[model samples]
Target chain A: MSASGRRRSQKYHQSTPYLFIAPFFLLFIPFGAGSVLLALGMSFVDWPLGQSPELVGLDKFATVLEDPLFGRAMRNTLYMLVGFLLALLPLCLLVAVLLKQLRRRTANVVQVVIFAPITMSLIAVALVFDLLYNERVGFVNGILDMIGVGPVPFLSDSDLAPWSIIALRIWRVLGYYAIILFAGLQAIPDEFYEAAELDGAGAWQRFRHVTFPLLKPVTMFVLVASSIAAWELFAEVDVLTDGGPARSTLTAVMYIFGASFEQFDLGKGAAASVVLAFAIIVSTVVAHRLLRSDDRA
Target chain B: MPKGSFAGRMGRGTVIGLIVIVTAFPLYWLLISSLKPSTRLGEVSLIPSSVTLGNYVAAFDTQIPRWMLNTFGIALLTTLLGVVVAALAGFGFARYRFRGRSLLFGVVLASLAIPEYALVLPQFTIMRQFGLLNTWAAVILPLAANALVLFLLRQYFSQLPEELFDAARLDGSGEFRLFWTIAVPLVRPGLGAAGLLLFLNAWNAYLLPLVMLTNSEQFTMPIGLAFLHSQLNFGIVEKSPWGAITAGTVISIVPLILCLLVMQRQFIGSLTAGAVKA
Candidate 1:
């Protein structure tokens, strides 16, 4: 090709990348980053529905902070997050380890069976759990009755409602996370376990020494991802309890939802959302740091 | 005991059996109860003596059919638009060395950390401002710009050998033709994976649609079902709505379940791949 022709083609190549990439930026700028900035701006102003916005600076945040219901929502979310991580981490780990022990065919079937729940809609899953937790016609209460135990108020009692909601969340997500960890486990060669056995390490020692450390990256991924999901708890609670039974299951998102939509207090909702986003970021950073510190050690 | 020993095998079998049953029983109950008489919802029996298709018939009479169509249309549009844009962007990032490329890519990845809840209110305001509220576009537009899909496809495109592109370019192939014909076909699996994620995310999305859509006709399956559930629980609907709920639940989930069964490898593979990379 001639020098001018080559120059033109080179220029075309330079511009082509921009043309290819422009579409994503076009949508993302107006929606993704734009929405976040808009939320940040909205958080500082008192924008009641159908009314002109008034800049209230940090007062909206202060109101959100002082609101007893927001406090409860955060507390409930934290309580459930702890319980959820406590239960889910070990259970999924156990499932992943046992899955590693099984033959490939058997493991695949078992994995699919357990992984099915994550595919189903949360609303449907919540409805199924609601029925199962029903006092009169539920299968769970029926079993409890046969065992001479009174029916459990899974969603009705404030104390149990959060845990009940957590259980449903765990059930839906267990296999999904476990499958991710299972893939992680599959990456750990059998040589490590065999070497541990040859060194007179028992199963527990093998796990403690060999499995846990190697699985840390995947485990950390699970920790951060699941905790983020835990923090954003809404749909399960919304469908199951509507943050009901004395607002026991009122998640941060639900509080935000109620404030913004039900009450039409967009500023308060935006403020609460800002707080929630900060919490999520801080927690994720903390988790990353904690895992990194352990990795160093 | 050793793994293959009798006690170990028995223990493993028992654990597997329990896990399968616990994980699967609720779905089983859902299927069975939907087939049972709606009037007998209070019955706690494990099995119904008689089966009826009445619940499904009753469900069809509701707005569920419309909700399903709305959700399907929205999810499909989101997937189609999301994948095309992502594919282009992914190819750009992988194959090009442009100014501010890293910064631009960083911006895209950073958006992943912003939870949907944080954006929903502002997105609602934007949609309302544009007079797009209560329309299918309201749901599809925001969801179509999915950062995760962009990230996943970028990872896929980055793995391709540059020699192929170079050879094609030397053959006087146009940039668009090279991407559309050579690069895209090479990354077909990635496209499938990205497409599946986008579709499922849009299909199962509740918060965005719930915030943007007020009319029942525009509600997605999740919102529609949640509405039905709340109505029944609050006693707004005195008659049995359990049948409709259960039947709707089944109809809503069956297609995705079938999709999972068929594409089990891709479903599991792509999810794991994304996490591992993340």
Candidate 2:
């Protein structure tokens, strides 16, 4: 209770908070920051596993640019990215809107059922899709036969393979985004909708103005998050198609994995990963800016 | 929802029904195929013609049980350590206004944008240097400091009443005591939610383990099943691997489904809560 005791105690409080937070820095500095720096350093050198390192300068980046596989992988990744966003964004939002119309119990059960995929193994998902995409003796082909449509090569055809992969992703993530957006929807005060109605706003008009903007932050978060995952599209590609059917499902991360581990070309893999990192950072930053621009308007 | 319109209600029901089928059918198909006789796995019947545990028996021939143990070990360790560390820092950042607080927090938050693919190459090299390659630590350490976990915990800690802390302080309770006794118990729900999310993320982790764990003995469930699926597709073995793949897939997902069903509220809460605004 003395003044000097109080002074010492206040000093203790100031410094002990640092101790409380020390554990994060201890792990993060080495595992997070240091590794990132080392990765950037490794990108310029030819550091194959079990081989003497040699500085390669920009050659790795140039090699990535010149590689035909890289081109195909990039194209495939972009195609999936575009197709996924085109479907996922509006579809999740629409699902959220429709969810509002359901009885509470039905909606909750439906939510749990659809959200089940997020918990399932991506490999399981890949195998399941592989079964469905089988050209012969598959459920899909059987259905097509009944409908008078020829058996479609969902995974075997390059043109359809990427889209098929996209469909699987959409199916996997639709519930996740829908639930997040629905939570965001719950945050929008009913007063706003009532005010919109009083102002003669129809459902479409209210959604176009009020719902969309209020949902913007969550939407942007999902966009960047999903886009990041899309860029790192390795597991499905690895399991389902193995970047096959002429590399139609080949992805940036798959290419990186093949180069680094399979071939032991660590430098090339690091370089490609660095390039992808920059793309993710740039896109995410742009997304943040887009969110800000909304505030500005 | 068009009020009092039977057609509109039917239309919504139809659409939702279709969506449910599209999403749920894959899981259903997996379970059914996993239970079917290997000879009948190729058949188009939605339900199995003959239910058998033969596929599961075959799948056990692979290293699935061992892989599951490894994955479970990794996820459990990651959750235990990650939650404790995140909780300490979460309490620190929540209660204290120390020097460079915002700067440190912002730096941590900024690291979220660095995708795992970008970090894996360097992380692999780091693991190699530490001689952690082919070990579970390679996966656990990097994944432990999740930005969302810290963010979720910090946000939850901030919501704790300052009066509780001050009251404890007035009673001469030390900071750690207050943190352990008051802050932690209050934010237990947040911690539980964050831990479950982290465990699932770690369990479902694929790329890092695939790259680091070269030895078949050390493979996690995802990578193991992936290897199994590849073997089935390539048919390198004499017998078909479909029965095993389906069975392995089914086994791989059971834990996740159990966890999700048990912690449905927390799983949904942690994910949707954080993503809603940030």
Candidate 3:
């Protein structure tokens, strides 16, 4: 074909793809990217509720730095992140490994039940957990009663509120994470296991040498995703604790929310949000880089 | 390995069975609690000796039905709009080589990393500016374009053979017709997967609805449940009806459980596909 003919055909071809993609960019320009830009612009000014917006250039960031609540929220976020990593990740991995050993039919049934909670609304989970955490009539208290132990303050005490949130997070995410890990496990060719078996490797040895190494990418992905997720934990806190009993579960997202909406301190809220987003992005980037290097090695 | 010995296999089976039971206990509890009479909700019984449907009855009488309707409407809208929009965008990114494609793709991926809460305030402000607060549009409009769904669809679309598109074009069909009849059918599995996710997300969405909808009539199930909790006066003198709350909790999760059961395979496949990607 001649160059002009080829150009004409290419133009028509390219038009189709662009037309197909227009909806996403059209929506995103207004909602996603536009909102982020607005937030960034809002962060620099003293944009309080019902007040004229004033540019305060870094003052809000300075104020957020001095605010004790900001510190407390950050601390709580870290606590929850650590709790999820320490408790949830291992439990999910263990469950996935165990499920992988089961018969296919049985595992399917178990997988459905396990993944059910992930789809359940956080509000529903919170309500159910609220019942479970009820001081007098909760199922947990009922169980404690059978054991002749005093009722543990699941959502009441500030000291224990974070743990309660963590418990809920674990329950909600374990199955989904386990499914992800199991996918990673399945991707490991059966020949690898067969080869290990020929070498007289035991199950534990096979797992350690084969499964764990192969599952690293999924594990890292889960770690970063879950950490970011745990940090942004809001619905459960809002519905269950309301960051209450002394603001024990006042996550960074909650703090940003209160600052923006409740207090109408948009500048401070934007500042906090910017900081939180930066922290997540940086941590995610660092983790990815480290994992990539390990992969290379 | 001689079947790994009967004793060892038995022990492993017992452990696996125990894990499955423990894992499913909360859902089982939800079902049992839902079935119990409203009065026996907190009576510390695993099995309800006498089951009553009054709580479900009460739920219907209260705002539960309205909440369910609102949730259903919004979720369906969000899923349909989100899937259609995402599928187009995903197809674009997968098949096209255009100006700024990489940059645009990066923006979409970045949006996935940007927490929804981070955008909620600005989104709320924008919605307020447009007088959309307390409306379903406020809830559905912002969610119409989901980066995760787009990314999933893009990956799925990219797996299709180029020859299919060529074959369709040779037949002189237009782009839209080709996509509608050929591309869509080919990507139905991906659509089903993305639809399940989008539905679950919209249904379970709390923070967006909580902030967007001010009226009780507009409240979704999660917000409605929260309102119910707040309404229960558990003061020193007044006692909360734990049975009713338990019943309410059970009612809220039933639809989600049903949806999962109906689309269990696709849901599992969608989840595992992303993780297993090389």
Candidate 4:
């Protein structure tokens, strides 16, 4: 009411926003931003656990670059990433499209069932898969035996190991990503389909000309999101394979984890982490560019 | 054929049925394998010939109860702290025009790029520095600063009508009061969604807990299972731990699966909301 009171309240309002927002920054600055910066600093030094870190600028990075295990990890990660995306993207789109045609209640129930795996502990899921993938006395091999196929070494044997891990990853996330694309499909009104039909377009044509184009944004989202997760592959491989049966399933994060925790080579771990981060960023950008370039044409 | 045709419907139905089976079978297997007798674990069967609670009884003999307690306690604390922090920040970013608003919000959004993998080493070092290693606080602290929760809540709060806040202001309500009485209650769905996501993420988290807590006594459910599993594989114990591993898997997942079932809409809806928007 009074001029001084009004001005004081105005001043208080400005600080109010900061008060509301300060908690996130309080946590973010020290934990979120600080740790990231600290990782960069840690990468430059020879920091073993429980000892003083010494500055050895770029040497850790060089060692990381030359480490054949690191190279193997990246290559395996890329191999799986491509396999994951190639398999996941189209499967998600197919599921979303089919799910779109189902009655609403039926669609929702199916979506929940499919999305259930993502909610479970990855370790628990890995254990279940490990049992399922076991060589002898395992369910998978039992079924193969029934069908006259030889017992497959899903977790053993270098060739089958990565694909086994990749299959596990796909099983967990297929429904989750599909549901997102399902929602994207839902947002595209029925009129789009009706109009396409009225124009004498067939089902495949309708999907190609209308559904596919409109769904690109969500597909791109799934592409980038799943690829990033794929690039940082760790827990499933670690628990199920330990990046093994000869390091066939070894991944970038597994490499980083081994460096930092197993060997206590924190500097090398941090450097590898930086390198992994760079790969994630570049691949993400390239994915965006790849998708975006197609948008115009 | 058009989707409306009978043949088309049959094909779609078959595919959907197969998808449901593939998705649901592992969970079903986890359940049945847990129920099988310990001696029969090596015997694969689509049906459990003899159901027994022996494995679950055996699971309790392990550190599972403590691990479950550790995981639920840590996840609950993370969800509580995470929701409150995100709500306040969401209200700020949505409701007020402050200096450094976009810049600060940009900083929050940018943190999502720093995945747990990248930050684990530094966070470990920092936790060790604070003398908090092998404690619940070590896991809860970093996870509580969740960028995704903030982003979700910010989107929720931003959609609220401005007139509600303006009316509260006219009643001489303080800024915090307006947020508490008006904006907070209005965003209950957002809160539920954010809380569920945070809880689920924390409960199922592996890497952070794996790195921070070294003591087996401090192990969360995932780490504990992994420990048992690795032990089983390496023959660290003479007798098999398969019985315990299968039973523990069931126990670890049941709570979150119940959560998912109860809040199925929010679980699916809010996640899709975040995915589409992000």
Candidate 5:
């Protein structure tokens, strides 16, 4: 081949890959990359919508830090996060293990039933839960009435509302996470279980030694995913309680949405969201390190 | 073990059964409530004395069909645009070694950790600046560039046999032809899965649409239902919107249910496939 033709071929080869991949970067750079930087920049300026922007430096962060609602929001978020993880991890793991032991047909049916909620929109779920949590004539109160107990205000009560929201989240995600963990279980080599049986290990011991340890990666995945989701709680609270009776279910994300969109305080809202993002990052990092470091120690 | 005692098996069955019932009761209630007459309001009975289709009529009157149309358009377009772009990029990344490839791929992966809401402020601002706010483009453009789909497709495409690519190239097929013909069709499962994931994500999206679109005319199904819910006077109206809300909820979710029924295995597998592996 001529040298000019070889160089032309090289040129075609070099640019072809870029042409193929350009669409991703083209959209990503402006939207994804630019959005992050814009959010960061917006966090610094006291820029409400349709107003003169004032450079506030760390003032916006300070305002978020000092705001009592911010604290309450953070607290409520953590409350849901902790409660959700506590309910989710063990229950999902148990369900996944149970699913593993089930006959294929039964497991498929159960998996679909369990996972049905995850496919449903959260707004719808929250709306259903709202009706179910009504102080009067709610199915829940009806159940309580059947047991000769007085009507208990599920959402009206401050302490119970967050838990109720957490329950809704747990209900939505438990089966989905279980399916993920069940996939993890299926991926586990059969030899390990056989080896454990050969050692005369009981079922619990077999699960404890062979299943739990091997499922660490997936457990960690669920941990971070659910935790991030809990941190970003909005639609559920918005629909169920609207941050509720006395701001009980007012999560960080909800507060951010209300501040930015409703109140139009763009700067503070951005700062609050950045802080929430930081919290998610910190928690995910801490959780991941804890999970990884366990293998070492 | 499969050889567990009868009582133990029964106990396990009962536990799982109770859990499923509790978890699914609200949905069942929603269905039954949608079918019930307004006279049966607040009745906690599992079955209604008389089922009425009035609520569905009310629900449809509330512009739900429009909302559903909007939602379906956005989700479908997002899925199509996202899957196609991601497929091309995936194929590129998989087949050809290029300059700064790892750096670009790394950036895409890193973007995964950034939750959608975290960047809402700037994303909103960007939409405003581009005059895309309130338009479907505001939601569609940002959503179409999903890192998850890109990553999943890249991985799937890479696993395809290299020999196929070589043979295709030797047959004098150009890169674009190779990608459109050889790569995409071969990764049809991956494409379908990724498309479905994108569709579902866009369908269930709330925050973006909530912030983006101002007009009720442009509202997606979720937001429309939410508005209907909020406006519902809880059986006070001559024809209560509660039943309509329930019916709307059922209508909105029916597509998802159909999607699940149609692609149960692929849906579950594609979603969880990368969960632990990452």
Candidate 6:
């Protein structure tokens, strides 16, 4: 083919691909990138609803930094993240490993049952949890009564309310995360286990040496995803507690929502969002880099 | 092979059984609570001695149906728009070699890390500017460009054998037509997986709608339920209708549960596969 002919063919090829891709960029540019920049700009000013936004230049950031409630929300978010990691991650891995050992049909049935909650609206889950945690007539309190324990303030007391929210979150997410890890577990070739068996390795040894290392990528992915999810914990708070009993469960996202809608403080809300976004970005990047380093090592 | 001891099998069975019970009990409680009579709900029992359809009836008579319709419409629209948009972008990245393709693709991947909450404020402002607040369009438009869906579809499309494109070209099929007829059908499973996920996410979305839609009538299931709960004076001496709340909760889950039952395999596959790729 001559140079001009080749160039003409390449141009035709490029045009086809560009046509195929134009819709996504066209939509995303307006919604995703545009919104992000708008939010970034909105963060710098004192913008209230129905009022002209005054350019304050980092005043909102300064306020957020000084606010006790903002500090508490940050603490609550971190606590929820840690609680989920501590409780759900290991349990999910264990369940996934156990499911991998079961008969395929039984596993599938169990998986469907466990994963049922993942599809249900968070509102429904929250309502159900609210009923379950009711101080007087809740099933949880009823069970405690049977065991001679007093009615626990699941959603009433500030200290216990956040845990109640965390409990609901853990329940909803464990099965989903387990399924993810289960897939990772399945992807490990059986031959690896077989080889380990020939070496007289016990089940624990096989899991510790073979399963854990191989599942690192999936684990890291879940960790990062769940951490980010934990940061945005709002539905349960919105429905069950509404950041009640002293704003104990007021997550950063919930705080942003309340600020924007409840107080109509768009500027401060935007600033809070920017700060939250920065925290998420920095932590995720740091976590990713650490995981990559570990992988290399 | 050495046979494991009976004790070993029993122990494993007991542990698995316990885990299943713990995982399933809350959902089972919701079902039972929904069916129990409103007056007798406080009489604690694992099995309801008397069942009544009154709670469900009351729920149906209330705003449950409206909430379901709104939620379903929003979810369906988002799924359709998201899939179509993602397919185009995915096909583009998979099939075309262009300058800055890698760089653009990286931006898409980076978007996966951007928290949805971070975008809520700006999205709300944009919706307000367009006067789309309290409308379904507010819910549907912004979510149509999901980065995860785009990335998943692109990865799946790129894995197709190059010979298929050559075969289509020989048949004089244009690139767009080839993608529509050949590539799409071949990647139906991937599309199903992505579509199902997008639908589920949209259906269950609470935070975005809570922020975007202020009108009570326009609220989705999540928001509607929250409104109901907020209105319920739990602290008042008057008897709170636990039965009705449970019934409403159960009603909210029925569609999702039915969907999961019908497409359990596809749903699970999508979730697991999406996670693996991430």
Top of the candidates by lDDT: 1
Query: What lDDT does each candidate get?
Result: 0.88, 0.84, 0.82, 0.88, 0.85, 0.83
Docking class of 6: medium
For candidate 3, what's the TM-score of chain A, rounded to 2 decimals? Answer: 0.92
lDDT digits (tens) for residues A1-297 of candidate 3 = 444465434624657777888887887887899999988888899987767779989999999989999999998888888877899878888888877877888788889988888888888888777768878667888888888996888988998988888988888888888988888887899899999999999989998789988989899978887888887888888877888879888889889989988998988998999889888888889878877787666
Identify the runs in model 1 with alpha carbons over 4 angstroms from their true place.
A1-11, A146-148, B236-238
Evaluated at residue B189, the lDDT of candidate 1 is: 88
lDDT for residue B233 in candidate 4, whole number 0-100: 66
lDDT of candidate 1 over A1-297, digit per residue (tens): 644478633634568899999998888988899999999999999999778889999999999999999999999899999999999999999989888888888887887788788888778789888778877667788788888997898888999988888888889999999999989988999899899999999889999999999999999999999999999989988887888899888889999999998999999999999999999999999999988898778
Over B98-135, each residue of candidate 3 has an lDDT whose tens digit, in order, gives: 89899989988878778788788788888888999999
Candidate 4 local lDDT, A1-297, one digit each (tens): 544467533634557888998887788777898999999999999988779999999999999999999999999999999998899988989999998888888887888799889888778878989778887657888788888996898988899898888899999999999999988888898898889999999989999999988988888889989999999889988888888878899999999998888898999999999999999989989998998898788
After superposition, which runs of candidate 5 have C-alpha atoms over 4 Å from their true positions? A1-12, A146-148, B233-239
Ranking by DockQ: 4, 1, 2, 5, 6, 3
Residue B77 error, candidate 6, Å: 0.7
Per-residue accuracy of model 1 over B55-84 as CA lDDT, tens digit each:
999999999999999989999999999999
Arranged by lDDT, best first:
1, 4, 5, 2, 6, 3
> Which stretch of 10 consecutive residues in model 2 chain B shows the poorest summed lDDT?
B229-238
Clashing pairs in 5: none
**lDDT agreement of model 3 with the native:** 0.82
Q: Which regions in candidate 3 have their CA more than 4 angstroms from the true location?
A: A1-14, A289-297, B1-3, B233-244, B274-278
Is candidate 3 or 6 superior in lDDT?
6
Residue A259 in model 5: shift from native, Å? 1.7
Error of 5 at B214 (Å): 1.6
What is the per-residue lDDT of model 5 for residues A1-297, given as tens digits with 9 covering 90 to 100?
A: 444465423534678889999988888887787788888888899888978678989999999999999999999899888988998899999889888878888888888888788888889888778668776547788778888996888887899888888888888998999999998899899999899999999989998889988999889989998898888999988877789879989999989998898889999999998998888889999998998888876
